[model samples]
Target chain A: MELRQFCSQSRVVIVAGKGGVGKTTVTAALALAATRAGLSALICEVEGKSGLAAAFGSDALEYDELHLDDRLTARTLAPDDAMVDYLESHGMKRFSHRLAKSGALDVVATAVPGMKDILVLGKIKSLEQLPAADLIVVDAPAAGHAITFLLAAQGLLDAIRVGPIRKQATEVVEMLTDATRCQVMLVTLPEETPVNELIETAFAVEDRAGVALGPVVVNGCMAPLRDQPDSITSLMAAGFSLTTSTQAIEAVAFRSSRHAMQEIQIARLAEQLPLPQIHLPQLLTAAIGRAELNKLADAMAHQIELLQ
Target chain B: MTAFANLATTREIIVCCGTGGVGKTTTAAVLAIEAARRGRRAVVVTIDPAKRLADALGLDALSDEPKLIDQQTWNIFDRDPARSGLAQGTLSALMLDTKSTFDKLVHEHAPDEPAADRILDNRFYRNISGALGGTQEYMAMEKLHELHTSGEFDLIVIDTPPSRHALDFLDAPERLMRLLDNRMFRLLMMPTKTYLKLAGAALQALLRTVSRVVGREVVDDAIAFFQAFEGMEQGFRDRAAKVQELIDDPATAFVLVTTPRRDAVDEATYFAQRLESNGLQVAGLIVNRIHPEFGSESPESLRALAHGNAAILNLADFREIAIRERETLETLTARIPSDAVGYVPLLDEDVHNIATLATVATHLF
Candidate 1:
């Protein structure tokens, strides 16, 4: 279950989390890890959160892939853009033009309910179908919508029972259902609401789509309290004589509480799932780049080893 | 003049709205903190069901009513001597529980207990009220209107629910009115009990068939839920219309909040466009977690020094910091209108209390 082993087995790996939990950063890091391992990987982002582009040091990304390194590439899927491309590819250029002229593209796109989700999923499926790539890492929409997108094929299949749509929907469902082909990772912070939602989302996914539940990545985990209890007691005993010293002790105590909460939640989740759990330490700084990503990759790689 | 400074002069209410997890809570907190620091008594009310305001303000707990952060009490300003510069104007926060707010709205609108009970006791009312995205949004507006009418604060900042249905809250009043006004629905349910009596046998038969198919009592529960809401459409709709009018008013300003990330910005942009199309005034945009620029040394030099071959390094250790900062700034400048955009730098710690919120306020204002 090393990082390479997982990527080698799964064609489509979805990274999902609550917003601001650094799904995009983790997606980029995992993609970079895959590339570093000598696998050709395309990091696809659906949220239009050019986080992948930023992580790869690119100003912008188009529907077409931008090479970040020899084996790693990144692209963003804009639903409207993907729809137009999809229409053109299917030789429905006239219909596409007519829809554009009618100014009904937006209406049609949204009115169909799960249409955007379908297009986004369709695009990810297309990337997964690419011949050269060993893996396609999707930085999906936030947890809720991502789940909706993952289940869109089934939803459409149930809602529309006949025709080419049913056939396409069936294909999408098959792709998602096969664990060896597709896997979903729930990314979460070590907190009450996120952890609660993560567990709920896992159950929901299991019930609805029967998609394989991959490991959960708890992002922004704080380091364990390094200073001894005696030292802390001594500092407290020393009184609030110095503001800096007092603040230091309080900060450590606060950090410990946050970290402990995260660990407890992670353990609870691990007890429920058969999958490995990876803990990514909170960085001292807010901005994460290649350096922080590599450290996360190393941590993930270690988790993968444990899984094996 | 700052973008927000201009907004402050014109807008009455600033609604910071977005999907969940996009920093909508933090954005609202920072905006209120900034306004208060600028000598205005600003109140931030969050309608997100999951309470994060206390966490964002670094407080252990928050109440349904506005709570002043004790930390801000230490600062004093001489220029606004009428108000203690140190205490200045106060920044207050509260969390709006949507379901409770909706119930309160029902109680306010109904003429008597019997009438209110009739509506509340309806099964349809309970199920749809909680499940409908529009209901949550509308309740949020109702809460906003309550705060606006109070006149206790100069500015009221609201953190809207995280959903596209957030607009439904603004649009709820109209939808509710439409539903109430529907002659067809009323006509069908006119002999409510008689209709229930006649349909009960058929519904039972259908439920039995459904139970056989699904191996569950889902249909029976659903039927019971609908039967309960039979005669209360008008009361609910009338209140909904009133709430809708409050949201559509020109006095309210919608502030779209997003992170510097592309997906968030795009969603915010889409929301702003939708608000504008619906004739809702967009006060501005608050882009959070912007990468702060480091001095002098370029990304290229750092990249060259670190080299592509390096295995483990933090972003701060190499030129990726400069690169990311530049790219983020460029994206912000290109996508967000300069006049309506406010940037909050990335902080080392999560913004969970008054001091950090004040720090965020300084950056934003």
Candidate 2:
């Protein structure tokens, strides 16, 4: 598959996964990858604290959009701002003020089920309506709440049958379930627990949210020790006596073992999920920045070429 | 004794927390197993719905109730033939079922069966009670309170959800209380008829605006749900107070877990500093899955020796990761006491079963 074709399959790509799985990193890298493929991308951060801006070596993002590059832009979206936007756009600017003044918005957002989530989803819906960018990537909440976050639209539609909230939720649901409009990309580590959770989340999103699943982004895969024997004996036979340090031997063994385990998990994921996998190498750094992100985006672009 | 060993045996409540995918759940289970090995009855409550804990315990499934590990399962710790039956204490584990816990709370607080049903059957309540933000954290605390008061175990270790929001496990009660005590909530609690008749001019205007924007039905549902809880507010308030008290008790200990990743370390540090501001001490810091120092050889020398051999060069790569991780841990250990820190090097495989968990315990204890 061509990177541009894959990028254009869905206008909105929601990247979700367990915490610490590098969902934010994948979101930023995917946006960069799309932009590299000659498409303008807008990345939306819903949780506000995902460190998306930091991935670009910038400060914290606000509700206002920040253009990172010529073709890439990023912004943070909070529910309160979305609520005010939803009302003002609905010709209730005066009502938005009164509710904000009385502090009922907090009550409604907190006390009512799905109000906070719907407000945000409804805003995203309007963005799609405006065709904000050629591609919009949402750095969604972690896996635990992601199902509920995506299902908030359906939940509201069921709970409130006759209201502007219902009408907004209806449109959000349409945008979410339509494959051409939106698809969810779940990220996970090449480990047992994360892989287990990713498979479960993928199923739940498909069954409940009725959303399409894209290629699974497997992050943090150990670089393979290609064309080299894992055993010290083989290396000695090959005339490389290297130092006699036990730590060196242990390091080789440890890396080989973890790589083997990761391979097993990746195989298990494919057997179960039946989805194409994009493997990202584990960077030997404490945090990801622009350079590391570019490396990941390059890896993603390379994988997309071989995806079929 | 190691700081973790002391806490496992002495602390009545141990809260295991960390950023996502940092092995917090496994740490909690290991701590509970350690407590049980030390002859204390322990139960671990996991907020993550994944069945990893169940798989570790060799169980098909885990419910809301604590299920005891059979003696046969505990026998995995009896590795030495010289000493049999090493696990003298008992261990039980359960996954927190947030919805049922919330439903039980509603039933406990409501004045009668009909009143409870009135709230439970509400469309708004049915949807939000289980899946709302902050509800899982609140209910985890609620279950901790229930288990603590029952006196069934000497120690309770809980695995909180993975995120920076895990801090909410501590603040959910206060946040909920503030929400319930908000003037807006009180106004919403007014019966529809009474609210229309008695609402002040500003409130009336607010209500009209709310109806026009969100639709009258949602407002009706909100008013009806709050009205159903009119007499039950005191009960809920009192329970929240007790939960807060339990959180403040000296017997409760928070254990911070993290990986060598910089973000995870930063989150753990932030969580610890916040707890410090509240005068709560983190009993231990567990750094899971750290890469050990591979060798003393310089990468340049190794690359020269290998003549660009891929396998040997890969060893150099591994060495770099090990050093990078060591540096990350150095920064983390500086913030915590040397005695309070436990480091577990990267294991060969996932800690999926009791055998693997026992292997981790050797490093932790």
Candidate 3:
């Protein structure tokens, strides 16, 4: 219902956005929030993406989940590894090893569309089913693919009417569509492209999977530097020279215009996205690491409270 | 050091790539449009689903075929078009549709109609063609190859899929080769040969036993797919090799597009290494959406220069961003060693139309 409540209650929380829109950062922030809220969280990603690893500031992740802190574990999930685990869970451990060795797992991951996604989802679902983890936050693929991923099971179920694969698809679909079980959050930047794409993706997710679309997390928002009670133009007219300090005037002008543009886009995002939204202020640090993620988590908590 | 830095007259195949969300699509579009304004026929191939490319080009849609832009919009851009060494060029763009391109490839490359129908009609192809790993990247190259070989344009620009690693597009051909040449792959195809019937029987039996473990339908789907693709495998292999050659050609160049963010810079450096390691050419680097570099002096000096002029100088916010971004970009540029590095100031608004793209192209060219 509420932002913090949804973060705590949902079995699986997926964060999605366009490429380079800071989806991984938002996912890590959510994971941190979930951990802080006392919900043991497992942050999942499609393996080989170092974004999550960079966000968490740890390279220890592999098939086994690395415990980052109390109640928080992060792991990168690969389709191939998920296939191996799927086979092993299906009681074909030796077969999986042989398949992996022969590189058939690559074939499976490469050739099959929904198969790869299903395997990854199956793994996430398994982790979600675990009693040890209260919530699972999946850092999903960028917009187009993320929607395809969430609807992969439904696509298969629609295509294959009667089969074991269909049955598996049904279960994944159930988990995804159930509001109490899942919430898909669309992370965005207060920019035109990402916000527009997020709107399209939100509608597509609802149309295709009927999943509960969580609040929009607007990352990289530039808030006002300080409340300037008066305009610089007035001061310039009040006696400030324009030509000598052209660089400063230009930089200040650029910053003010950019901040003004962000506000317009933010308003556009609010009017366009049907779901609730939380704005995460832009980070000024040169690098993004755990400290930035924790700071974002704290900011996210404040926004959650504000929205409530 | 940048071979194709002067993209205006380079007259080469420019492939824009970098980590996702760093503006490859827009860069590719801008370059193509710049080429067009310079009087060459240029086409931009983009796989990004955002449709920003379409908007930037002032078009409602960009399909596989190169559609002419609205004359009114072109006229507006054409007014001061030659202001920046621009030629009287023409531009058109193609947004990639991998599924449609696959269908076209099937139509042209497949042995016969029924053979094409067999692969096309297969349920697996219906569901998986678009989603198949590397298909988008592979097909983008395939389409690029088709366009490059054609005598259509003076310049061709390709925007790669916004993958985490831009190398995925470059590696797609080799990876596709591996998938086709894998040991299990040959074993799976054994059943198609008449002379290998006995071995096929053995392998097929083992497959059935394996099928029971995973699922009959999935394994059967794989079997059916391989059977349908048997005739076309060689064609795919040949084209993949051709694309590999095309990428490594001297007339083709790769442009790394990135923002000034630390992650973008890190990935750009890593991407540069991957390109160099693979023996591909790095034409230049275009750092997109960077905060405007304030002044030639330090931020403190720049702020101090504003004495007596303002009650409040908001230069700190922008000055801080500008400095951090410059440092981050310097870290990447130092590693790249490409003198052709160009920085496009972060626009007040997103580059939405051809006019805005024209302004960006000024910085790039």
**Best-fitting candidate, measured by TM-score?**
2
Model 3 bad stretches (over 4 Å): A1-4, A109-112, A161-164, A229-252, B1-5, B70-72, B75-87, B191-206, B295-314
Q: Number of clashing pairs, model 3?
A: 8
Which regions of candidate 2 deviate over 4 angstroms? Answer: A95-103, A229-250, B79-84, B188-198, B300-306
Give model 3's DockQ, 2 decimals.
0.47
| Model 1 deviation from native, Cα RMSD in Å | 11.1
Q: In angstroms, how far off is B257's CA in candidate 2?
A: 0.6
lDDT of 3 by residue, A1-308 (tens): 34457677678988888888888888888888877777778888774565677566677568888888788988878878888788788766757777788777765554445877887887777777774478888889877789888888877665555644556677888889888888898988887878788889999898877988878998988776454425545545645445424555565566567778888888998897767788898886667887888999898877887874
Pick by lDDT: 1 or 2, better one = 2
lDDT digits (tens) for residues A1-308 of candidate 2: 99999999999999999888899999988999999999999999998887678768787888988989879999887887888888888887877876766566766775456788998888887788788999999999888679989989998776676778888889999999999999999999998888999999999999999999999999999875666455667677767665533344666666678889999999999999998899998886777878999999999999998988
Error of 3 at A17 (Å): 0.6
**DockQ per candidate:** 0.07, 0.56, 0.47
Instruction: Give the per-residue lDDT digits (tens) of candidate 3, residues B245-349.
Output: 988888887889999998888888888888999987577899888776655455565456555334235564466677888788778878898747788877767
Error of 1 at A40 (Å): 16
Measured with C-alpha atoms, the lDDT of residue B125 in candidate 3 is: 71
The sequence of per-residue lDDT tens digits that candidate 1 reaches over residues A189-304 is: 87655776688778877778788878788887877654433443454454422332333344445455666767787787777655567777776543566676778877666666
Could you tell me the TM-score of candidate 2? 0.94
Highest lDDT against the true fold, candidate: 2
Candidate 1's interface RMSD, please? Answer: 11.8
